[model samples]
Target: MPKSWPDQLLQMLLTLAVILSTALTIFIITLPSSYSHFQSGEITEEDFTEDDRQHAGRSGYSYYHNHRDTDGKLKTECTIQIVVLGDIGRSPRMQYHALSVASHGGRVDLIGYVESEVHPDVQRSRFISVVPIKPHPKQLQASNRLLFLLVAPLKVLWQVFSLYYALGYQTKASKWMLVQNPPSIPTMAVAQFVCFFRNTRLVIDWHNFGYSILAMRLGSRHPLVTLAKWYEGLFSQDATAHFAVTNAMARVLKKEWAVEALALHDRPPNHFQPLTSIQRSTFLASLPDTAKYAANIEDGSWRLIVSSTSWTADEDFALLLDALVDYSARAAENERIPKILAIITGKGPLKQYYLNHIQHSKENGKLPNVDITTAWLSAADYASLLGSADLGISLHTSSSGVDLPMKVVDMFGTGLPVVGWSKFEAWTELVQEGKNGCGFDSAEGLTQLLQDLFGDDGQRLKILRQGALEECNRRWDDEWMPVAGQLFQLKP
Candidate 1:
C-alpha cells in the first residue's frame, strides 16, 4: 500500500526528531569535565568545607550545603528543583517531596502548571517557591484526530520551550532536579539539556512507564508508541538517579530498562489521619450536596464508601457501575444488606460520561440501594471524606501493571480499608488482602466482597478497620526522609 503525502511527511518529521534528540543526548554525554565530575560521586555533603559554605552563602545556591552547629557538626541543607509535567497541586507525591525538602531546611523550586489550588501546607511554605509553566494552548479539538500528528509536535515544541524557560530563566539553578516520569517525553529531554548547560544532576521519579500509558490510547504496535518507548529508555538511562513507587516497578526498571531505581513507596501525610465521630459529623454536615447522605450516615442507616478517580482510561468505572447494580439487587433480596452512599471524587475528562451513565442507572431504578456522587474536593475536605468513610474502593488497574495507586495509599492513610482491583502485580505492595483491604478481579467479585464486608455481622469490618488504623502511623515524612532526603543530601 502506498502511503499518503501527510503520512510520509509525518514519518520524515518523526525521524528527524529522533535524530536531533539522539544528537543532543550524545552531546550531553560527551561533556568531558561535567560528565566525569557528576559520575565520580566525590562531591558530597560531608565533603563541603567552611570556605565552600561561605561561597555557597554568597552565591545563594550550591551543589553541596553544610552548616556547622555550635558543637561543630555539619548539617545538610540542599537546594533542589522538583518538576512535574502535570498540575503541581494534583501531584501529591511530588508535593510531598517538596514539603519534605522544605522541612529539612532545603530550598525547592516546585515547577509545574498552576491548575487546581495546591495543598495549604505547600502554599504556605517559605522554603518552597513555585515556578509556574504556561501550558500549551488547546487550539485543535479531539475531532481533528488526523491533524493530531501536526498538532502533537507543536504541543511538544511548546512544552519544551515552556519547560526550558521555566528551568533556565524563571527558577534559580539548583544542585538537583527531581522530575516525575510517566510524562517522560519533552520533560526528560529538556531536563537533560538544562543539566548539561547548568552542570546540575537529574533525578527521574518513575510513577509509571510513559509509553505504557500512551499504548493505552494508541495500542502497543503503534509507531508513536514504539518511538515513545525508545525515547523514554534513551533519556532515562542518563539520569543521576531514579525513584520508583513499588518494588515491582524497581525490579522491572532494573531488569527491563537496565536502570536501577530506589523503591520510594508513597505514604499519606500527617493531615490524612483518622477523624473522630464528632469531626466526621461536623465535616459531613458542611457539605451541601452530601447533606442527605450525611444524615443517613450519622444515624447509622447508610454506609459511606469513598473512591476517587481522574476519570482516565486505566480505571474501569463501568466495572464499578456493574458492581453497584449487582449490590442493589442483592440488597433487595436481603434485609441485612445496608444502604450505600458511594462518593467518587476527583475531576477528569470522562467524569461527565460516568455521571451520565450513573444518572441513567438511577433513572432505570437499577441502583436503588446505591447512591453515587462525584465531587471535586479541596485537600482538607477530601481527607475528611476519606476519614469519614466506612470503606474505600480503588478502580485503578495500572497502565504499566507495576505501579501502585496513590488513591489507595490515601485511603489507607485515613484508616479506611479498601476494595481494590486484584488484576495488577503492584496491588500486593499496598493492598494487603484480608489485612487492611480486600481485592476483586471482576464486578461479581466486587459485588460479593461488598456484600460480605458490609452485609456481615460487623466482625470482619472491625478487623480491617483496626488494620487500617495501624497504617496511620506510617506517615510520609518518616518514609521519605531516609530515601529521598539522603539521595538529595537533605538532612532532617
Candidate 2:
C-alpha cells in the first residue's frame, strides 16, 4: 500500500486496459447477426430448428405444423393470413374489400393500430376479425418536440430490429401473406423475402403511389422517400403479383420494374346498384345544404359538382375553381354564366388549406358565384349526388401523371362526364377528348373544355355516360377471384 509512485502508476494503467479488453470481447460475443436469412434468400432445416421456432413464435407466428397429404407427398398448408395495416379512418373501403375477399373464402386477418372503437358494421363483416395493436404511447403522439427529442432515433433502431425478427417469423409461418401499406420497407422486404424463400407468394396492393406523393409533399431528399423506394424495389422484385388501383399506376410499375403489373380498380360494394332518376332527386332533396345550393342556380346557368375524399394540392381543386371562374366570365357576357357550386366531402390535413383557398378566391373576385360546402355522406348518398349533377370534376398535378383517381371511375359509373387533368395514361386511353370525358393541360385548358361541353348540350348528351361502366365490367371483373384461388392450390 505504501509503494513508490512509479509502481503505483503502472499497476493502475494495467488494470484499466484489462477491463476495456474484457468489455469489447463480451460485446462481440453477444451481438446478433446482421446478415438476414431473408436478405440472402435462403431457407434450410436449421431455419426451422428449435431455436428458430422459438424465435418465430415470439415474433407473432400464429400457426405451425408438419404433415403429409393423402398422396404421400410432403405438403404443408399453414394459415394464409393477409394483414391490412394502416390508420382506420372514416372511409371503410379497406375494411369492405378485406371482408369481401374473406367472405369469398380467402383467409384474411386485419391488423391495425386502432385509435377509435371499431365500427359496428366493420366488426360484423366476414373477415375473421379485426385485431387491435396499440402503438407505444409515446410513438402515437407524432409531435415536433417528441420527434426531434426521441422518436426519430428510436424509430431507426426499431426498424432494424423489427425487420430482423419479422423475416425469421415469415419463413416459418404461412407461405403467403398480404401486407397493406406497411410502415417500414426494411421489415416488409425482409418479410417478403422470407415468404419467397419458403415457396410462399406475396401480393403487393399499391393503393396509392405513396413514395411520389411523399416526395412531392416533403422534399425528395427526405429519408422517407429513400425508405419507400427501397420497399418499392422489394415489392417489385419479390412479389408473385402486384395490384395497382389505376391504369396510371400499372404503367408506373411496369416502367420501374419491367414487370406487367395488374390493375385492380376499386369497385363499389357488391350491393351498390344504380338509382332511378326519381330516387336520385329524392336523395338530393333530403340534404338541407344541397337544397340551398341547388336553389342558388338561376335558370340557364350551369351547376357544377366538385367532390373528393379531401381537397388537396394534388387534387388541384384550385384549378377547378379557376376554371369555374373563367367559365362564368365567358358565360356572363352571353347571359349563360352557370351558377357554379362546389361540394367538398372528406377530411385531411389540407382541409383548412382548401377552405382558405376558396375564401381567398371569393374575396379576390375569382369565384364570386361559387359556393363550397362540406359534409359526410354514405357511399350510396354520394353516388346519388354525383348522378344528379350536370358535370363532375377530378384533377391532379404533373407529379401524379400515373395516378388514376378513383373519383373518375365513380363519375363514369354514375354516367357523369368527367373533366380533369389528363396526364394519366389510362385516362388518355379510356376517355375520348369530348366523348366520355375530357382531359386538360392547365386550368385555362380545362375551362375551354368546360365551355364547349356547356355550349352544346346535344353533343354532351350523346356522349356515352355508360361508357365508363362498360369499361369497368370488361376490365375488372370477377377474374381476380380465380387468381386468389390459386393461393390455396388445394384439390377440389
Candidate 3:
C-alpha cells in the first residue's frame, strides 16, 4: 500500500520537530549558568570528621587548598572529578585513579554509588571526597528480563537527573572529568553534556565495548543492540581524550571509531605487595574455622591455591572445579603429591549455585584430596592471602576478546604464579606462556599443567614465582603516572 502525500508530509514534519528540539537543548546547555544559586563549593577544615583525619594520617595522604612559595604566591593546579556509574567500592581501577590524583596533589571529587565498603586508602585520602549517587530503585530487579525491559528507560531517566544534580550542584567545578564506559548509555552522553556547559575536558576510560556486552543478552543483530552501538559511537567521538585497558582496544577505537586512546594497563596498588613469612602466618591464624588448612600450611604438607571471581557469566568457576576434582583423585592415588587447599573468594549472583555444585562434587567422592573453601575477604586480607598462596588460578574469559582482566594483574602484583584462561587475545598482554604465568584452554589442560607445576616438589613453581616477583616492581603508580602525568595539570 502506498502512503498519501499528507501522511508523508506529517512524517517529515515530526522528524524536523525532533531535530529542532535536539538543537534547542544543546543551545540551552551552552548558555551561561543561571543555576549557580544551587551550587556550593566551600569546604572547611571542620568539614572533615576526626575519623577521616585519622585515616588520612595513617595512610600518609594529605591535601592542601593553597600553598605559598618563598615569594608568597598561591598555587592551585589540580582539581578533577572521577565519575563511575557503578558501585564506587567495587570499581578498583577508578579508585586507583583517585589515589594517583590525590598523591599528585590533586583534589578529587569521586562520584558514584556508595554500596559496599571502599578501600581503606581511598576512604582515608584527604584529597578525595566521595560524592554518592543514588541508584534507581529497580536496580535489584535488573536480572529479571521482563522487569528490565519495562523500566530501563525510567532507570536511565533517573540517572540523568541524578548525574545532573551531582555534577552541577553537589560538586565543585573541575578542570577534567574521567568516566568509566561500560554503562555508557547515560554516562557518556550525560558526561559530554556536563563538560560542554562547564568547559571541562572529558575522558572516557574504555574497559570494554558496551554494545558488545549488550549483544551477549540481546544478540548482535537485534535492533536495540544496533541502536546502542550507534549511540556509543556518537557520544564517544566528542571526548577530549580516551584511555583503554589493552593495546588491542586502543587500536579498535582508532580503526573503527577514529578516536585515539592511550593504552593504560591495570597494575596492582602498593597494598597488594607480597607479605613476609611471619605476616602470612599471622594472616592465616586470623581466619576463622580453618585450623586444619592452617596446620598443614605450617607443616609445609599442603599447598594453597588462591582465586577470586565475581561469579559472573564471563568467569566459569566450574572449569576450576573440574580441574580440582581431577587433581584430588590423582593426589589420592599418589601420596607424594601434596594435599590441596583451594580458596575461592568473591560474592555474586551465581555463588550459591557454584556452592551447591562443589558440595555435590565432594559428596560424590569426586574430590578426595582437595579441600575447597569460598569466602569474601577484606582488601588487606585478600592481598595477604594472595601473597601467601603457592599459586593462583584465573578463570576470566573476557566478554570482548580485547579486554584483559584485572584479577590476573593483581595476582602477578602479589608475586603469585597464575594459571589463566587463555581463550582470548588480550590474555597474552598479561600472561606469558611459561614466564610469569601459564595459560590453559580446557579443564584437562589445566589439570595436567597443575600436575607438572606442583608434582616435582614445586621446582617449576618457584621459577614462575620469581618471574611474577619481577612484575611486582611495576606498580600502578609507575604505569599510571607516565600517561596521566602529562594529561592532568597537577603540581607536586
Candidate 4:
C-alpha cells in the first residue's frame, strides 16, 4: 500500500486539518458566556409589570394597572402597600420605621421574631400589623459556628415563606418593601424575587454591610465572611433604591454594587423633649444616685459628664479612663481642686471588666479628682439624665466607616455637647470642632480639651452646648417625613 510521495503528503495534511477543526470547535463550545448587568437577578421582562418601562424612576417598583371598575376602567388605588421586616421590639431603629408607617396610615405588614412579646401598649397600630416569627434554634448557638452559618440562610428563607403566607399575596395595588440588613443574607435577592412576582417595589435600608459585621465576629478571612461579602455585593444590585447610614457607605453602595443610594441621616427620637425644672426634678428623683447630683446642681462645685456605650470592642474605653486620670493630675498640679464625676451608662459583656477596673482605681486611690458611677435607666430617665450633664464623652468609632453610633445622636438630643474620642469620617460630619463638639486623637489631647472646656467658668462650654442644641433641632419625624414621601411618592 506504499503510495507515491505527493499522494501520501496530501493525505497527512488533510488529517491534520480535521484535528485542528475539532479542537477549535471544542474551544468555542467551552468559552465563558457574557452576563447582562440588567439588574434582573435571573428574572425576565415578563416577570415585571407592563408599566415598569414607563416609570423606572419609581424606586424600580412600578407595576401595570390591574385594578378595573365595572365599566373596565383602570383604578389607581391610594394604598401604599409595604412590608417591613426586622426585630422591631428589640431594635429602636426598626421601631422607628415601622411606627412611622403605621402612624401615617400606610398599609404595612411588620414581620419579625421575638422571644416573648413586646407589651401591646408599645406595639399598638391600626394599619400596621405584626407578624411574629420563630428563628431556628441553631441560629442562636454560636458554639457550632460553621453550623450556624450553614443554617442561617435556610432559616431566613423559611421565614420569607412564612411572610408570604402571612401577607397572603392577595393585593393588587402598587407595593413597597423595607427590610433591615445585618445578615444581609436573603434580604435583597429574596426581596427582588418577591417584588417581581407580587408586582411591588423594593427598598433596602443599609445599616452596615453584614459581611463587614461578620468580619468583626469571625476574622475577615473566614470562608463564610468572604462568601458573604462577594455574594451580598452581587445580589444587592437588584434593589430599586438603597438608603445607607452615611455618605461613605453610600459610596460603597454605588461602587461595589452599582446601586443608587442616598445617605439618610438618623435623627434623635422625638420623645426626648425639653423638660421644665419641676418635671426635671421629678424625673431625677426617680433615679437612685441622680438626686444627689441634682441637689448639687446649684453649687457648681462638681461638673457631671455623661458617657453612654454598648461596651463593645470597637470602642476604646481605656482612653476615657486615662483622660480622666490625666485631667485630675493636671488640675492638682495647678491646685485647681478639680471636681468631675463621669456618668457612664448602658451595659454589655465588657461592663464587668471596666467596672472592676474602675473599682480597683478607686480602692487604690489612683484617681482622686474624678469619680465614676454606672446607671442603667429606662428610656425616659436616660434622656432626662443626659439633659442634666454639663458635657458628653463619646468613645464610639465605627468598626466600619459606614455606621455612626446612635449614642452620639442621643447625647446631642439632650443639648449635651460631646468630645468624640475617635476621628472617623462620620464623627467629622456630626461634630464641628470647637463648635457643637470637639474631637481628639489621644487620651492626653482629650484631657487637655476637657480642662479647657471646664475652666474659665465654662464660658466656651455654654456656647458649645447652645450649638449642640441648635444644630440637632431636627427630630426623627421631621427628617423622616420628606424622605418617606419622596421614596413612596406621597405627601407628608
Which candidate tops TM-score? 3
Indicate whether candidate 3 or candidate 4 has the larger lDDT: 3
**Tens digits of per-residue lDDT for model 2 on 248-268?**
778777887675767666654
TM-scores, all candidates, are 0.85, 0.69, 0.88, 0.72
lDDT of 1 by residue, 1-492 (tens): 999999999999999999999998976674323322332222234544465456553222242334434554433346788999999888999998987886666778899999998887776654568889998887833424478666788888889989988888787567788999969889999999888777789999999999999888878999999999999999998899999999999999998779999999999988898998999888888886567778888875688998899898899999999999999999999988999989998878789889999999999999989899888889988999999999999999988999998998898898999998979888888877898999999999999999899898878988899989887779898888889988987656
Per-model lDDT = 0.84, 0.56, 0.83, 0.67
Model 4: colliding residue pairs: none
Clash count, one per candidate: 0, 1, 0, 0
Candidate with more favorable, higher TM-score: 1 or 2: 1
Cα distance off (Å), candidate 1, residue 337: 0.9
Ranking by TM-score: 3, 1, 4, 2
Report the C-alpha lDDT of model 3 over 229-303, residue by residue, as the tens digit.
889989999898999999989988888889999999999898899888888787777776355588787676788
Candidate 2 is scored at a TM of 0.69
Ranking by lDDT: 1, 3, 4, 2
Candidate 2 stretches with Cα past 4 Å from truth are 1-80, 89-93, 113-122, 133-175, 181-187, 190-201, 218-228, 246-255, 258-260, 293-302, 398-400, 461-466, 472-479, 485-492
Number of the candidate with higher lDDT, 1 or 3: 1
What tens digits encode model 4's per-residue C-alpha lDDT throughout 105-166? 34455666653344232344433456665554544444355776776667777766655544
Candidate 2: the clashing residue pairs are 302-338
